[model samples]
Target: MPALPTVRRLSLAGLALATTVAGVSMTASAKPPEPAELSAAAQVNRTIQGMSLEEKVGQLFVLFAYGPDAHQPDARNTTLYGVASPAEVVAKYKPGGWIYFDGRGNVQNPTQVATLSNQLQQAAIGTGLHVPLLIATDQEQGVVTRIGPPATQFGGSMALGAARSTADARTAAAITGRELKALGIRQDYAPDADVNINALNPVIGTRSYSSDPKLVSEMTAAQVQGFQRDAGITATAKHFPGHGDTVDDSHTALPTINHTLEQWNAIDAPPFKAAIKAGIDSIMTAHIVVPALDPSGDPATLSKPILTGVLRKQLGFRGVIVTDGLEMAAVRQEYGDAEAAVRAIEAGVDQLLLPPAPAVQFNAVLDAVRSGRISERRIDESLLRILLLKLKNGVFFEPYVDTAKAAEIGPAASLATAQKIVDKSITLIKDDTKTLPLSNTPRKILVTGWGVSTTQNLANSLAKRGAVTTVAQTGAAPSDAAIAGSVAKAADNDVTVLLTRKAWDSKVTDKLGKQRKLVNDLLATGKPVIVVAVQDPYDIAYYPAAPTFLATYGYAAVSMESLAKALYGEIKPTGKLPVDIPVAGEPQKPLYSFGHGMSW
Candidate 1:
């Protein structure tokens, strides 16, 4: 939102070089050295060589945005949004790139995505800079996926982690990477390395892998390898130092992590460190406060002690450091416009994501450099990293698909992969008394709870597997109809399968007191009450009364399909619970711990 500082002075040679590099022809008689006409490496070298202190500092600032507005006839939204197009931000922004929160138009298939990305890269190349942009998205899978539809949708980080096998995790990542690459997306802001430490953490619930750092580390590595090494997309390990423990959402405000530095190092930092060691290209900073790490009490985005001292110096992460989002409450509410950008850069962050207005922010960064608020050398450091990543990703040299070809790919691969993972990851936790493997005979079954039936068609696949009567509920609260239906179904049905889909969120905990009462009441009927959790395994704590309990970790269509198959004995329940579902409020911890599952 602030203007960049003006260039104080450039040597005659530097001006000539910049002009020449910009492709402005000079007279033969007065030809300055064509330093800019050199190769990409040469241009970078020349730019670094010719830069006035101010020009170099401006390079570190990266603006964030959604897709370019297709509504504008002139297509002038590029400058306004900080990206010429959604894809160009990643291809041209290079080491510093845009973090996309939302996009214009539809992103339902891989082909459209690929075409959009190809166009984006073309714009970057046309800019005359060899460096590729670092395009990023928050594709955590399950509840969060930027490229949905035709793309296969894995349940979530936890669902993948529940599979426990690194192979499974890697396969999921590889699938994600392949789909992303097909669509022209190069950066995946995923494999959320956060361990879900608190049940009340309103944002990171299903997004996180597990509360166990070791499991999170393994899954993070697998995902990184799958996206970067296998699929040729850069993977970012995010919300560092870890955001799983916080009860607040950074999008609205800063959350505090009260753990001591020792605790964080032991519990939270391992997954991030593992991701970095696994050659992850970037690490996204969380807008959270770790009072133990930064006693001054600033969010990690602005905390030098955390960003530079801990993540850089101690952890030795040499990759690009990205801020979560500049417009987030933690940043916007705390610092003024120019100051936020300056502090983040000085704090060692390589990119500023989703700034309010990119062009304005870019100008402000330029101004900051001129004013000596941000050092030119600091800018060079980030720019170099970005260029290096572009080189590594082969963006400068590789040929990408055009828009037409991209449209043809669709999202079939993604959907198929999602279906596979869901089929493999759904586990039957306990089927005591052998209530599962339901009879093929027609029988009325009551399916009640949140996410049971939605416009998304989550329950459609399940209904095809057996005779199912569906009832929709909302939130953590169980509906009266759902409760009454469960009771009524138990009274007359040959079998009663009370499928409770808990809506996943940071604010909701495992102990569903009201829902538990309903399950207990259904259990009182002395009929087979099979409680299926189409969300987190933690919900099992609420329905201990049920003879059979299942954890699917998601309510996506694929998950529902897989759950249906498992119920009919079409597939074995070999998947494990990825996180510890603590018992009620006792905090006995581990009603069913990580890696615990039962075979059919």
Candidate 2:
């Protein structure tokens, strides 16, 4: 028989027919089935048939740990705040999944994380569903990783891509997965497949692999495979369609990508398509607007044309589809929370990620279903997918991690692996005229900008080789006083190294106007200012006159250490620009271009 029409599109009589059909199947089943004998789909269907409207609705919404009111104790008797107790909300709502955030005053430790995961799973089973709940963390690596303390910190996606081969990418992902799995995290929302088209993109700069879709695809697939294979963890290829080309941050507001569908297919979609084909378990939708794909101008999270039409129909993705945090400004500032949840689900998102409030959002989904705005069958479709994930991961049979075995894996092994990948992936973009390898003799060196202080534990690795003097730059205003002081000190020494952080892109070009003027002033003083962009490659566009320029593509400690070593000739500048740096007035293209690093 043909499937009944969706509830929203169906009349009351149609609903009656659909309900009757569903009831008949349940009534026909006489005996209780064994857990091992039940297929994941059957288990999900049976469970869904038993849930109340409220419980079914609760399964669709994932609450944010850092959102306001998230700390309040849930009526379900689950703990709600801090990394040590993340499962409290999950236990309370029997939520389909958990979305992690770096809490304000909570420190994340392995014991705490393991405890939380255990509790979440215990809670899911307590619901009598006998299914494991999804435990997700934003371990995007580089700037967005949530696991801190003893966990190894590698440079983000950009630095990993800067490695000479895709093997390094795989190794990095393996390390990420090992640590996350050790902590009992089953899902990693990572392997950002966004093509870094706009240098000004604030969030994606270091998080993206490279501007080249082919390279990103290769590296993304490698990382996904590594995460799945090494850790037995499900990996999510994220910000689907793509978020790399946009100039705005979705957390603040919605940014529009002007590319037509054809352009998107050629440049932005390859990495995602590649990852999906490689069996990536999930894909997270972006909140940005792609007018060509969805002329409605709504963010992709709530756009049916983009989610169902393009991603599902054209791309043939059968895995779960998760939305970026619904509390982000893109959704909350406009549609409000309840409307956003409805639209996201109606648009085909299986999970409403990081909802502002789990209970309120859960109630809203139920209201939508009861009002016939969203069909209960639609809810079942998503629940079945979630259950399938749990089954595939063996969550039903073996839900808890062996804490004793976890202790054996230890943080030391993972840290060593992370350090190795970080060391290998460091790229030295430029050391022109043999200007690097500074004399060991004490020299007056000036270091300033984004990551100058070695006091930060994260900054210690980058300051090992230099006699560093930290200087600060005021917005759009050159530091004449500091620059003059540094120049005078350099005149008294054999060599003067002026270190400054580079700008990420054009949208924030004016923010670095002061630093640009400082570089020019240092150059005029006849001093070779080796400007190392300790962030993204976009910084090169602002300082064309610097005699020696280097791009490290990240701000991670190891990346900083690599930059410092490359500066004084202790190590050769062997890293290449992973993306093109466009010239001034010539389309503002990249300077050294992707794969153009120099080796001594």
Candidate 3:
């Protein structure tokens, strides 16, 4: 959105003299070109053609803030960037986008978030840059949600996958997108397109839709439409070529996938293809390496063969391609600070996200363009995509939001929609003792488990149902003393409802052993034990002897309400398993096949 190049203006006498010298008639051939006649793409090209080398490089970066205010600095988080405040950083670097992380003090309430976004935008525009800054967040809901209460916390992709309803998927996306747009955030890194085929995947368990590529494809396409067409915010289908099969977290270590070219085409490629067909404006690259696609051992973020060859040529996606955080160990496995940005751009990625040293990365790429290692045309290709997306998503015209109005939206109605999604996704995977549909409304219950918020929410939900509820203080990874204390408390309760987390994983040896033991010991007390798996439903496979079990896909508040209502038979459980759960020691055998659900 830089200023359009204009013809020189002449004074009245000079205009008459020039017109006489030119000897042109006052006709169509003599009419000057108007800005309104330019195509959107042409205007974007002019904007890119008008940028400085520094501004063009700035257009390719999306950095996260550590401080709270635009002009004020935070002392607690000073490690990532220098001591510059958020506004100061924007003025200095002029990043094309700014992403918020609540853990870094960049986001708080709706009004505060809106104010911060406006301040960032104001700073960027103040630098004589005509295009508005793209504000974003990882509001994927479920576990990775950055915003707090008052914003709708939808059960993420796996919940929609479990429900197996594209309407529900679209609804989830629309609601979350509305909340984001209201807060002046124009983009969301959500609708995770990875097929969660590996049950033990450490990073992308509930983030992905399902193990089946067809289901992922349907949900991915629906979400793309919801986010772009319905909600008017840019949706990024992320972690390309599948991050769902890895056991290692990319934040800490590098993980490699051995899926053959055929396997990738069948498993990982479909969701992206569907996304492209659905007109997804942004595609985030995976940091993991796919040996079958590229035997050169480069991760997809740096591999030109994977990003350019397969994604661009084979799939024909002309949208903006973004990289995962360059600070992550997966991208940093081979290269360091400066070269990562240069190589990622060389690989056809349009945006470089959250590299550790933004200044170093920016200068290196600028120098590369000057040294002829990377062409200026290559940079313009990326800028064209970015600018067109900005124009498409209404970022240029409507970058600001009413801070007060933003605080009012996405609270009641959006939360109801979010709960509706989770409510439909509560899968009753096991019921051996018919312990559900409790006849006595005032039954004594113990809510214990991995997620403290979920446990407390479940306690609140059951209490509303007239049950005397007791919540144990055991953390997710509990100690033996805490488990023993919870067991002692279970003797008084009529039914002990406990939660268990990840159990079936090769990398994790402990495997939620204490949570499993807590459930068994609770059952030994002659109390009806209702176990709910918050994250991976495979948590129940470790405790095969349990009488009653359920899989909520996630531990969102709505899931707890669904669990409470299903327990009392107020509403029937209609959800099915999105993935197959294996027995404790057998990875190949299935304990409960996909689409397994029981109802009264």
For each candidate in the order shown, give its overall lDDT on alpha carbons: 0.68, 0.68, 0.80
Global fold similarity of model 1 (TM-score)? 0.82
What is the C-alpha local distance difference test score of candidate 3?
Answer: 0.80
Which ranges of candidate 3 are over 4 A from the true structure? 1-42, 76-79, 505-512
How many backbone clashes does every candidate have? 31, 16, 1
Distance (Å) between predicted and true CA of 236, model 3? 0.4
Cα lDDT tens digits for candidate 1, 267-351: 9999988998898888999999999999987889999999999998899887788888787888777777667777888898887
Candidate 1 Cα deviation (angstroms), residue 74:
11
The best candidate in terms of TM-score: 3
Cα lDDT of model 3 by residue, 13-85, tens digit: 3322322332321112333433332344345556776799889889899987776678777653345566557
Segments of candidate 1 deviating more than 4 angstroms: 1-40, 47-96, 99-108, 125-132, 357-360, 408-418, 452-458, 466-528, 588-590
Task: Return the TM-score for candidate 3, rounded to 2 decimals.
Answer: 0.92
State residue 135's C-alpha deviation in candidate 2, in Å: 1.8
Clashing residue pairs, candidate 3? 70-87
